[model samples]
Target: MKILFVEDEATIAETTIPAFQKQGFPVDHVETVRDAEAALSVYDYDLILLDRVLPDGDGLDLLAALRRAKDATPVILMSSIRHSVAERISGLDRGADDYITKPFDRDELISRARSILRRPAAMSRRVIEIANVVMDIEARSLIVGGTAIRVARRELSLLEQLLGARGRIVPREAIERNCYGFDDEVSVNAIDVSLHRLRKALVDAGARIAIVTVRGIGYMVEETV
Candidate 1:
C-alpha cells in the first residue's frame, strides 16, 4: 500500500520511512500541511499518516477538510501533545480512523495501520482470490493453480490493485501513483516492463487469468474463458 506521511520532524521521518518500506509500503512524506494537500490532489493514497502539529496549521483542519469533501481514505492522526483521552476522542470524532501518540513503537504503528486497512471502509482483505490465483496479502504469497510463484514487489502491488478492483479497469496514472513512491525514479516504460514480466510469470504458473491491456488507457485482470 502507498502512504502519505505528514510530519515535519526529520529525525522521526528518517526512522519511520524505512520501517514502512521494509513492509513493502511505499511512502510519500510531506513536512507541511500545504505539501500534504498538494500531494493528495495529485495522487490517491491507501492510507494517510497525519501529524497533529504542523508548521502551517493544525492537522485536524486538514482531516476535517477531507471528511467534508467526502474522502473516506483511512487516516491515522499522530501527535505528542494530543495524546490525552479527550484530545484523542476529539481527533477520532474529527474523522480519523485511528490516533497514535508520538514516541510510539514502530511495530505498533504498523499493526494499527494493518488493522485499519482490513476494515470494511478500507475495502482491503487479508487474502484475495480471483480465478485460479490466490494472494495472501499479509503473507505476501501468491498461489496460482495450486503452485506458488514469486512476484516482484511492484508487480505484486499492481496485481493487488487490479484484483481489488474486481475486474474494473485500473488507470495507468493510478497504477503509477499507487505502485511507486513520489521520490522513486521510475522509467517511462517501467510499468509496461513490470506488467510484461508479471504476465509471463502468471502464464508460466498456469494461472487461468489474463492481464488485459487497453490501448492508451489502462489494464484489467480477467479470468481466461
Candidate 2:
C-alpha cells in the first residue's frame, strides 16, 4: 500500500512513517498543506492520512480540493480540534472517510487504515472462481475444477496477492514485498521460480486459468480465454 501523510507534527510523522513502512507500506510524509498539494500532484496514493489542522491551511480545504480534482483516494482526518459532533460532521462532509482524535493509539490507527483500504467491496468475493480455478479466501484453500491442487506456502501467498489484485498485473517487486517481509533474503529469481512451479502444479491439475507471463513486466492471473 502507498500512503500520503499530511501532518504538521514532526514527532507524529517521524513515528508513523517508519511504522507504516515496517508493515510493507510506502509512505510519503508532508508537514504543510502546500507540501501536501505538491505531493498529490506527483504521486498517486491509496490512502491519505491528513491532519485537520495545518500550518498554512485547514485540512478540510485540501480534502475539498482533492475531491474537486476527482482524486477519490480515501482520507482519514487526524485532528486534535475535533471535540464536538459538528466538527466530525464537517470533516466527513468535506470528504474524510473517517476521523481519529488526537493522542490516538498507533495500532488502532493502523488497523483503521488497513480496514479502509481493504474494505469488503474493494476485494473480490470470498471465493473467486475464474475459469475452472477456485480460490477460497475464507478457507485458505485452492481447488481446480473438482480436484484439490496443493501449493506451497510461498506459492499460495503469491496467488493470493495476484487474486487480490483483481486481474491487474502485479509487479515482481510487489509480490516479493507482499510475500516476504522487508528483511527476508529474496533472490532476484525467486519469484520466477515460484511462478514456474505454481504454473506446473496448476497445469498438471487441469486448472482452467493460467498465470500469464507479461514479458519483462510481471505476471497476471486470468481466465484461459
Candidate 3:
C-alpha cells in the first residue's frame, strides 16, 4: 500500500522512509500541510502518517479538512509534544484513526499502521485469498498452490494493488501512484517491466492466476480455469 508521511524532522524521515520502503510500501514525504494537501490531491494513499505540527499550521487542521470533505483515508496522528490524554482524545475526535507519540519504535509504528489497515473500516485485510493464491500482507509473502514465491519490492506493491482489487481492473494511473514514491525516477516502461517480471515469477511458481493487460487502459488479476 502507498503511504503519505507528513513529518518534518529530518532524522525521523531519513530512518522511517527507508523502513517503510523496506516493507514494500512506497511513501511520499511532505513537510508542510500545504505540500501534503497538494500531494493528496494528486495521489491516493492507503495510509497517512500525519504529524500534529507542521511548518505552516497544525496538522490536525489538515486531518479535519479531509474529514470535512468526507475522505476516509486511515490516518495516524503523531506528535512529540502532544502526548497528553486530552491531546490524544482531541486527535481521535478530529477523525484520526489512531494517535501515536514520537520517540516510538519504528517496528511499533509499522505494527500500528498495519493494525489500522486491517480494521473493517479501512477495508484492507491482513490476508487476502483468491482461488488458490494467498497473500499474507503482514508477512509480505505470497503463496500460490502451497508454494512460496519471492517478489521484488515494487512487484509486491503492484501485486498488492492488483490482488486487492480481487480480479477487478486496476487503473494504470492508480498503479503508477501506488507503486512509486515522489522521489523515485520511474522510467517510461517501469510498470510494464515490473509486471513482466512479476508474471514470469508467478508462472515459474506454477500459479493458477493470470495478470491481464487491458490495452490502452490498465490491468487485472484473474483466476485461470
Q: Pick the candidate with the highest TM-score.
A: 3
Over 4 Å off, model 3: 123-125
Which residue runs does candidate 1 get wrong by more than 4 Å? 123-126
Q: Could you tell me the lDDT of residue 18 within candidate 1? A: 86
TM-score-sorted candidate list, best first: 3, 1, 2
Compose the digit string of candidate 1's lDDT tens values, residues 99-203. 999899999999999888878765556689998999987666899988889988889988988888888999999899888887789999999999999999998
- Model 2 lDDT tens row, 36-142: 88877766667899998999999999999998988788999999977699999988998889999998888889888878876674454457777778887544579
Pairs clashing within candidate 2: none
The Cα error of candidate 3 at residue 140, in Å, is 1.9
For candidate 3, the TM-score is 0.91
Alpha-carbon lDDT, every model: 0.90, 0.79, 0.91
Every model's TM-score? 0.89, 0.60, 0.91
lDDT of 2: 0.79
Q: Where does candidate 3 clash, by residue pair?
A: none
Model 2, which residues run further than 4 Å from truth? 124-225
